[model samples]
Target: MSDEQIDLLFHAAVELQQRGMWEQALTQQREAEGLLRGQPSGARRDERLAALLYGTGGSLNALGRHAESAGVLEESLARYTELGAAPTLIADVRMRRAVALAATGRGASAVIEADAAVRTHLDVGRPSDLARVLQLNADVLADHGDPDLAVASADRCLRILLQPGRPGAADARYLFLAARRASDLHAAAGRPDPALAAAEIAWTSGREQGFAMPSDGLRMVVRLRESGDLRTADRFLKELRGLVPDADPASYPTPEPSVTLAQAMAATGATGVPALDPRDAEAPFVPSQRSAAPFLATAHATALSAVCLSALPEDVPHGVRLGLEAHYLFAYASEAQDSDLRYRFVTHGALWARVLLALTLALRPGDPALADDLTGWARAVVARLPPTTAEAVEIIAAWIPFLDAQDA
Candidate 1:
């Protein structure tokens, strides 16, 4: 009976590991493993042994003992098979084992196990768990000396996550976690734009919950790519090699974001697109004036899910005249030859383009009315203006993706 106390200790160890207390978690895990080994050999004892082994193996992995974790996890897997563990548990074990194997330099074996683990997850895994397993598969593939396979795995994970309802995954937090991995993979694969978009989404979501992202390196990479200054980027990378060769630990006051959580969350649903800077003192998306009618009514009527985007209305209020007033500011500025407004458009084109894409996603491929209406409205407006102006040309270019999808 004394050995049964290992179960409680094992659970606590897992909790500590999750909280990033690796050393304490490892100690508790070893204690649990030792106590379980003292138990009499029986059906219940075998099940406890399986669980304790799994916990200890996981703790080892958390503490970066890849080879040891792999051995312990393999033993746990055998005990799980012997005890006939549920499919989910079996799949979860495979996922962690794959990670350990990859870290231990057993690339081929790791990939095999990862693929099997994903298959198992697809059959019975919740979206939250599935996203994590997919990310693990991607990371292992990356370390397996096959960048292509790694990129493919990462892309697959994004597809699964952004699969309409699945993108909502478990919650905003989980979605961002998956998105962050997706961002890194995309960036590594020479796709900076998508990487930047993914990072922005993750950062935005996390910031809404007071979570700060260490995205200094990511931002620099993206800016370097945009500037197309390869030599400068290369030189910067070289400088980074020894800049932090040695460091001293220091403590400072907890930092605060430029915008508050409530403000950031509010901006998530707004149509006003602002240039993204982590330290920008101004709110990004609050329009100077509010419209009397809803613009995303059609999207709301269709199948829409996710955080703030899910809270729109199904239709414009009966008598309200919806208008794309926010979008017209650029056109009006160009027409009036307003230098300041034109400068904003030139400087923030990318963010505005991203906003347009976000808006376009609300259009369901199966339903074309909204897209048709938007296209025709833009066409009509541009027809009345000087089409050769840079603003006019750029605006149309921004809409090309949505228009092409409609044509298809």
Candidate 2:
């Protein structure tokens, strides 16, 4: 109950949180809060309370209690606003609150909060702050269905971050985010060059920052495919698979089978060029084999697979076709989860591969029914995909007719 005891508890809570013991951390945080509440009111009371609320809210968010986390963040935001803290502090609280709101399905409210945070950062007139604001704005714009604006915001952020003397971690993060937005925008605009360039920048920056998300690698492969660099894309896919293994069959949120199917197809066209061993690369983050849940593991694996498949040769072998079919069956047999659905729908890596394969078969100068099968699969998957995934799927689907015409 003493001040010393409270400090000790707070430090312990932080350590626990860092160790991935969310529940224990939350318990310790709550204990610390209770100790603080029992003390008399004073000048530092509000500050102490704000810290406690912020920590509690952050822990709750990590534990997937979005609604509760939002409540705590809302309280923290109110207190930070009353204190008239520096723009940086206020912006941080607002950003956290916006994330919580988004997690709870309050998309419109989240965007408003994020926009306000961006405005506050801009008002502060710091290049770093401005870069952060632009990145946040990019995310909000992407959510709002304005890919062009999102890409522009990210580009602006990246320009600032790339300037000399900026913080390395912050610059890397902004550049990575910008690359992602640019890639998506280029793909949507049907421009392969810009997308490939953006993807390469993002992948290189992310690797340098020790951030090895599956999405980063997948984006690179996708852009390479779009640019007709199948050989490089295929090599990249093999490296990704080695980084993240396939998920177990009994996991709750399994990835779509289509991803593995696509990878199998792509591998067939690999030039067998010896790639630089990832272990030898001076990457900031070395990819590890931590046993994360089925959802994350599967989704990451699928993303890599999808990109690989998308980069396959036009005339793939029958053996590869058989392997793809088997992988597809495996994906289907896996339990359907949100991660799987999102990967399938939003990334559309699998759909792209299937469509490409169908197109290849149909336009073979003597083949038929390729369009029908592709259309049928696209329709079925499109109906089940979320809005984020819908746009990518639609774009790939639109290419089907052109492929058919080529055959005719």
Candidate 3:
């Protein structure tokens, strides 16, 4: 209940924190706060209470109680402000709060907090600390679909980390992280060359600097290769294997191609479409697990038509139409990383959907109205896909809108 006892509890909490006993430390800090607040409230009380709140907030963030961490950190900031806390201390708490906010999916707010930290660190001339806020800003921007700024901020972080005469392990680690994130952002933005370059930097820096990376990042090289440079894939794979000798290539995820209509029908134990002859029913569509982000969806639409048109069976009544629709479906089924990629996929897939619908009408010349059913089938097929995001669900719903009252 006394001041000495409160001080002892706070010191014990700090000790627990030093030992990585965050939960216990949280409890100790909370008790210290209760003791401090039990006395008559004053400037000292506010300062002491703010310190307790700061410790509790940090522990909560470490425990991944992000929303609660943000709330407590905000309270700490308000108290600190009331007590006229130093700029460095305020910036430190704000930086932690920004991380908690980002973890809790408040990207816009997280950006603001991170920017504040960056400004503070800049004024204090702590380039290493500022690099953290820079990376955090980049990540939040990327999640918010601002890939350009994300890439830029990542580049800035890397520049800052590499400025020191002899960059230490932490500097190298941050540089690697920034490069990796920059590569992904570039890829998402459909800049393959830059993406490959960033991936190369990330992988090479991580290895040469002994950064103790959580992963060798081999998959990124594969992605770079798959996006445009097939040659790089082999080289990166070999380099990654050498860099991480303990890693198992077999353990890497095998990309699963999208299920074709024939495969889906077989899986569902459904018969072939009644319109097509039994002998010519097996579709020629070969769906792959690919998204348009690394490329344009419109390009896939055009390419799929050019590639599969000749292979389609014109001998059967609706063979060409079925094959074309199946081709587009295969291309559209690729899982996108985010809404932009999904939107592009759907946009391209819809173009083929319309063309196939027209062909269906021509095939059934007697029943021109049957075009609606064909379009409906395409929409339904696309809708059957497991939507991963709200935007993805919207894209599915609008998949064949022109066939009905809906628009692309």
Candidate 4:
């Protein structure tokens, strides 16, 4: 293919991928591949082929076709290895392959690949590439339920990223992920104070950089709820909702499962308060429109609204419940990381929301399996929070009694 044609295909593939038309992006990439195959082999030809394969793999991954992504990325890795490509280039492909493996549920294999990539980047003296590998390594570790190691890897990356003259945005991103993993580890270990501190750092850094990611703030709210400081937690929740207006409810990303459990606690009045109207919940706490009013005075009004609304009775309109759940999920999912917390929170929240909707609006108690599924989800959320959110834990604790009584 002509250089001009390859360039056009590459650009087209990138645009399609960005637009979330992954299938179309893959199609464009395949066309580029076919064009390249017709050309004579040379150094430049190999480089173009590598680029096409890498781009194709990325698009396939974006489309959730992980196996296909792994195949394409493997091809790219082989070509890069053959060319004796620069350290960063090889490290990048290794990172991509590791991610594809993790996505395909090969966590142990992913960790091995990611570790090698991290070592390669470190050896090559590329701090940025090292940071990326560390982040990906943390992800794989977390997925494998090794929170301590995940936190350690993330913390190491954060240390490097916070050094003098580091790139601001990327540094902020690393700090955010590191804080998130640390908070999760703290929570799992029943250390609330450290979790709270880590969450605060994550939120502050993200906000300072105008990161607009919600997962960090969502984690903070969960930790605060666990600490029995509902008032303070409300403030963070308000900020979370305000930061992500375009976030989709069903697939919103959260930093951890504790955040979703907190939302669920609010929904059931287990937090020892009445739930507020989801719409009005965020409305009262909007930080951008400050006044002398207590709710209006804070920087994150939207989250406060969520806390208030979640405390309300389940008898509220189905649409209102769904909206509240959506907001909660959206806030939780807003973080940029692909950690276990993000996955669990989004998946659990989606399942819980559906169950609530079905019970309150569509199905009867006699509906086979619905109640069981809902109960199972509630238990999962409760199991995830750390001891720091004592209020949240107590709320869930009380729920067990309540549910027991109802069952009796």
Segments of candidate 1 deviating more than 4 angstroms? 159-177, 206-213, 220-408
**Per-residue accuracy of model 4 over 53-146 as CA lDDT, tens digit each:** 9988888778888888888899888888899888778778877887887787654346545655665676685787677677777776666323
Q: What lDDT score is found at residue 332 in candidate 4?
A: 32
Which residue pairs collide, candidate 3? 257-289, 401-406
Superposed model 2: Cα runs more than 4 Å off: 17-21, 170-174, 234-408
Residues 185-210 of candidate 1: C-alpha lDDT, one tens digit per residue: 55655566666666666656666654
Give TM-scores for every candidate, taking all chains together and pairing residue i with residue i: 0.50, 0.54, 0.52, 0.54
Clash count in backbone of candidate 2: 4
Give the residue spans of candidate 3 off by over 4 A.
1-20, 169-173, 204-215, 223-408
Prediction 1 TM-score vs. true: 0.50
* Model 2 worst lDDT run, 10 consecutive residues: 282-291
- Candidate 4: Cα lDDT at 202: 79
Which 10-residue window in model 3 sums to the lowest lDDT? 277-286
Candidate with more favorable, higher TM-score: 1 or 2: 2
Tens-digit lDDT track of model 3 for 1-408: 489999999999999998889999988888888888788989988888888888888899889998899898899999898888888778878878877877775543454466556557767847787777677666655553134445667877776776757356657767777888877665655566766677777877877976535354664655666477667666766766676766553464443222233332333333422221111213110112122232433344354443333333342223333344344333344322334435554554454544454445454444333344345455654654455556446546555455456343
Clashing pairs in 2: 210-285, 257-331, 345-389, 346-389
RMSD of 3: 17.4
**What are the candidates' C-alpha RMSDs?**
21.6, 18.8, 17.4, 18.6
